[model samples]
Target: MTVRPAWLLPKGQTREDTRLAPVGTWAPDGEIRTRDGVVPGGQPFAATGVAAMQLQIGVGRAAVQGTTAQGAYPIAVDAPETLNFTDGNAQFARIDSVILRVYDGLFDESEQPLARVEIVEGEATATPTAPTLPPCSLRLWDVTVPAGASAGVGGIDWGSALADRRRYTTAVGGIIPTGWGLSFAGAYDGQYRDADGVLERWNATDATWETYRAPEPPVETITGGLSVASGWSLSSFDARRRAGVVQFLGMFARTGATLPANPNIGDTLVATLPAGWRPIVLLEALCSNGYGFGAAAVGGDGKITIRSWAGGNNVSGIEKDTNVRISAAFVQ
Candidate 1:
C-alpha cells in the first residue's frame, strides 16, 4: 500500500505583496471578459480572454437506459474525459501561482476558511499549437497523492506535480459537519488577497475590475505592452461614460487620463499611445470597442497621453470631443 503524507501544500496564510492571477484577460476574437461562471478550486485555471473554466456538462441517458437493468450498474464507471486544449481559443494564461487552501465549513457551511493552499507558477503553451494538439495542448499536472495525512506536508508534494485541468473529485473518504467553497482570481477577479479574496466586477456593463481592487494595501497587476501604434484604440459610445485609459510605463509612477463624453462636436475616442509596456493604467469612458462591443481594455495611466486632439484645435485629422474614461489605484 502507498503511504500518505501529513501536511498538504495549503493556501498562503499570509497574502503576498504582488497579486498572482492574470488580470483583465481578453478573448482573442473580441475585447470582452468572460462570464463563463466561477472556476472551481484546486485545479490549474487557464483560458485566453476570460477566466472561465469549461463546464462539466453531463450527458442524457439514451436508448441504453431502457436496455440496461433498472437496478444494475456498470462494474466500472468510465469517467468524463477532456480532449487536451480542445476549447483553448484566443486567450492563453500562465499560472502566476496556484493556491489550494484547506477548508472547514463555517456555521452550517457559511464560510470556508482558506486554511491551506498550494501555489503554482508555470506558463501554459498554446491551447492548440496547430497540427501539434489542435488548439490548446494543456497537459495537466499528474499529481501522486499521498495516502496518509500524517505522511506528507498537508497532503501535498513540494517540487512535484499536484493536479490537472480535466477534473477534481474527492479522493479520500473524509467527512465534515459542513462542506467548503473557493474563489478563483481570474483577470477580472483581481484582488486575490483582500478581506474576502473573491472577484467582484467593477463595471459589469463594461466588464472591468471593480474599483475596490486598486492601489491600496492590496495591490493588483496589469501586463504592460498594450498601446496604439501597436494597431488600435478604444472609445465609448455614450452610455458607459466614466471611461479612461491606463498605461504600462516601466519603473515609473502609474498614470491615467480620461476622455470627455461629447459625441456632438467630435467623435469621442481614446487612442492607444505607442509607448513602453509594464506599468499599467485604467481607463473609463462610455466603454467602446472596435467590434462595437462598445468597450475594450488597452492602455493604462503609466504611458504617455495622446489627447483626442493635439494643439487646442483638432490636429491635422484629430477630433477634440472624443471621450474616454480612465482609472487606477493611487497610494496615499
Candidate 2:
C-alpha cells in the first residue's frame, strides 16, 4: 500500500511527491472538490492586446483540480507571459483558446507535474468553434482569428478578436465573480455570488441566482383619491405591498341619521387606488358592513366600488351608525 501525506513533505520525497503535497494544503475540501477557475482579487491571467498576432498575459494565480490521483493544483504566473498565435486561414476563420494547463508525469511519462500557459488551436471552418480543452486545463481567453489574418498581411484586430473566457472562484463560502455562474452550476441552495456588484443567492427550486432585496416596510397611511362618501366616515385605513401583492385595510361608518335605500348593483364609490397600486384585472372581495355582507369590486382603472349587499330589510340593507370593513388584496 502507498502512503502519501499532504502539507508536510517528509525526508527523501521526490519532485512528484512535493508537487502533490500542496494539493489539499492550499484550500478546503469543498473548494477543491467543487471549484476550479481563476482566483479572485488580482488580475489572474488577464490577456491584453500586444500585436497583430500577439497577446500579453498579466501575472496572476489560479486553481485547477486534476484527476483523483493527481488531486488539485495551484498555478501562479509570477511574471507576464507574451504568447503568439498562428496566422489565420485564408479561406475560413477559427477560434483558439489560451489556457493554463497542468501536466502530470503520473498520467504520461513524458509530462512532468508542472503548470504552464499554452494555446490550443482550433480548426478553420465556415462556422468555427472554440477548441475543446484537455483535462487539467482552464481556459483564459478565446481569440477569434478571421480569414486572411496575419501580422504582415491584413493584421488581426485584437479588440474584436479577444473574447474573455476567464471565470472566477474562491473559498467555499466566499462570493464568486459575476460570470462564474455561467460556467459553474450552484451545488446547493443558499449559495451566494456577486453579479456585477449585485448580491444574489442561488435558489435551488428555481435553479437561478435571485437578486437579494432588503425587506421594505409596509405603507401605513393610504394615499391617492380616498374620499369618504357623503353619509360615511373613515375610522382607520392602511395599505401594504408584499411580493407583488397590494392589500387594503380600513373601516368606514355610516354617519347619516337614517338608513340608505339599497342602491343598484355597483352604485357606491369608495376610493380610487393610485397607478402602481391598481390591479391588472378587476377583482372582487366579500366585505362585512357590521350587520350585513357586501361585495366590493376593485377595477383595473383603480376604482373601488360597492357592488351589492345582503341582510337587513330588503329595501335598505345598510343601516345608519353601521361600519363597513374594507379588507381586500390584489396583484399589483
Query: For every candidate structure, what is the RMSD over all alpha carbons to the true structure, in angstroms?
Result: 24.6, 10.3
Which regions of candidate 2 fall more than 4 Å away from where they truly are? 1-32, 180-183, 196-198, 205-208, 215-332
Give a tens-digit lDDT track for model 1, residues 166-253: 3222111211011122233223222221223443443435554443544434323343333433222433211111113222222211
Cα lDDT, model 1, residue 53: 25
Across residues 239-319, which tens digit of lDDT does each residue of candidate 2 receive? 777778788876878686544545534457766666677789988966676566778887888777777777554436666
* Candidate 1, poorest ten consecutive residues by summed lDDT: 59-68
Model 1 backbone overlap count: 91
Model 2: worst 10 consecutive residues (lDDT sum): 1-10
Per-model TM-score versus the true fold: 0.16, 0.57
Residue 101 in model 2: lDDT? 81
